[model samples]
Target: MMNILNKILKRYGDIYHPHKQVMESLKINKYLYIVLILIVIEGLLGQYMLYLNKDIWGIIFLLFYGMTIAIGSIFHFKYVEKKFGSLEEFDLEKMNKFVKLVDQEVKIDLTNKEQNQIINQMILEKLERENIKEQKKRAFTGGIFTVLLIPILLPFIIENNQDILILTVIIMLVGIAIIFFSFKSILKDYSLKYKLERISDMLKEILIFSLRDKSL
Candidate 1:
């Protein structure tokens, strides 16, 4: 089953060659996540202020948080803008074929040294993928914790009030809904990471063979 992440990669036609663009896109995604974390922190602070009866300050913080999230989510969705992670579609299948093409058992000339260059880029991409995966896992864990702990802990933190209970439930549900989708992405990232590492190892073997042949 192709997840929405893979669908976005294919639908937006960002999977073309000159894959360096994917690297740039990965950088952009990192920054976007940083922005997202900032928004989350802002909202947390707002909620805390409201708990303390600082309603005006709470509203100001929450207002900015909501606006930033709304705008970023809108632009990232490919509905109005270039779409987040748009150029992050590297063809792992093509990369695997590239490794097989340079197999020692096969008779092919290494006329294009760019093969090594491409593989090096892929290693970097794998590192970037690891970074993204770490972020997603963190989000998943944090969301899960919030979803579980909020209900149990909130009652003890504050006096028993119906409104506060309702608010805690709302926050818990939001946490669950938001991070549930990330599990699929986390799995996909692992699959891609494994394939990339295998391809990297295969290319390294070819490089060794090439060096040995040159020495003889």
Candidate 2:
């Protein structure tokens, strides 16, 4: 009974997961920096084009810019998924190698409680990262469609007052839909984060046991 309970608890334990903080800090700062720079450049260009006799093409470019930003923001999930998957696969291989080494009777008496605890923590943290990445991918898909619909419908509504009114309503509806989908995406991310965290601790515990019992 105790063994079963420990197994369950380990699956839910992510007592020291720094990867979450690390991922968020790096992702936010890197993307924000690029976006800020782009916004500045966009502003300067917009002003210059405005001075050039209210260049219609300038407005078009601004629309394009907005669309691109939205698309790019969501598209980042692909890169994140690919990069994180590779890292996770590498880590898994390392884990397997370490386990095999232990099974081959490398060393036996080095295993203990403290080392197990640390391993559990590491595994849980990694699990959380993977879950978050998956959620991001899912969210990005929904986000892309929400963003694309706006630009597609925008051009058609600029024809007359009735069209303008209809466009305004459609835009409002799209905005609402985006907000709804975003919340759903965020919820998925949060749920996955929690699950991965728990699993990570359990895996880490297993790794620790294998690493310490190298002599089988």
Candidate 3:
């Protein structure tokens, strides 16, 4: 029993850690949580209104609430990113610091070629790890949204109106498609292999400059 519980905890921890790290790094975890709560409240309120047979008003309210939250969250994210710098910039600074510290401790007798290779390897490893974390995070988010959509659309499915059911199905499909394509785009643009290669190239250039400076 204890072993089973431990395994469960470990599995979930692995799944959750990537997103937690991202939210914390961006310093928007609390804000995002609040937005999530507001969204849930909005959904519940809309559902209640619909149950009360105020379909038009409920939809109008939902649209208004959703738009407000979406716009507010976008602005909030922008402000936070502006204030703290983007996650990419933060990660780059972390890598730079790590490289600087390693360089300081490195023996002066080490050849420039050797040092360059070591730094390149380190950057690649770090970026690759980050890439894995990002992929995991995106997968987790997609899974969550998929699950949430089920309950959100359940009422429409149960309704006797064939037209409403068809519309619901179409909307759900569209939502799923958006999520799918978004994930694909992220994978293409934010691939760990690509980022690692880019970082490696940039680091190599910097290292070359540093070697020249040292020789002068």
- Give candidate 2's whole-model lDDT: 0.57
Location of the lowest summed lDDT over 10 successive residues in candidate 2 = 102-111
Q: Clash totals for all models, in order?
A: 0, 9, 0
Best candidate according to TM-score: 3
lDDT of 1 by residue, 1-216 (tens): 124223323322232323544454445465566667879999999999999999999999999899888877665545213542332333333433444444332333332356555544656675686878678788767877767767766765676565766677767776676567566666767666654555456456556656776779
lDDT of 2 by residue, 2-73 (tens): 343244433233222355434553563476456646756776676778789678867866775686567656
Q: Against the correct fold, how does model 2 do in TM-score?
A: 0.32
How well is each residue in 1-216 modelled by candidate 3, as lDDT tens digits?
334323322332332346755565446445666666677788888888999999997897699678868886686667666865875665555445435543454422122677567656665666666677777877877786678766766666777456775766767786887678777867765654554565567567556756887899
RMSD of each: 15.7, 14.1, 13.3
Q: In model 1, where do residues sit more than 4 Å from their true spots?
A: 1-114, 147-183
- Whole-model Cα lDDT of every candidate shown, in order: 0.58, 0.57, 0.62
Error of 2 at 33 (Å): 53
Question: Which is the winner by lDDT between candidate 1 and candidate 2?
Answer: 1
What candidate 2 gets wrong by more than 4 Å, as runs, is: 1-128, 131-147, 195-216
Model 1 error, position 39 (Å): 53
TM-score of candidate 1 against the unseen true structure:
0.35
lDDT of 1: 0.58
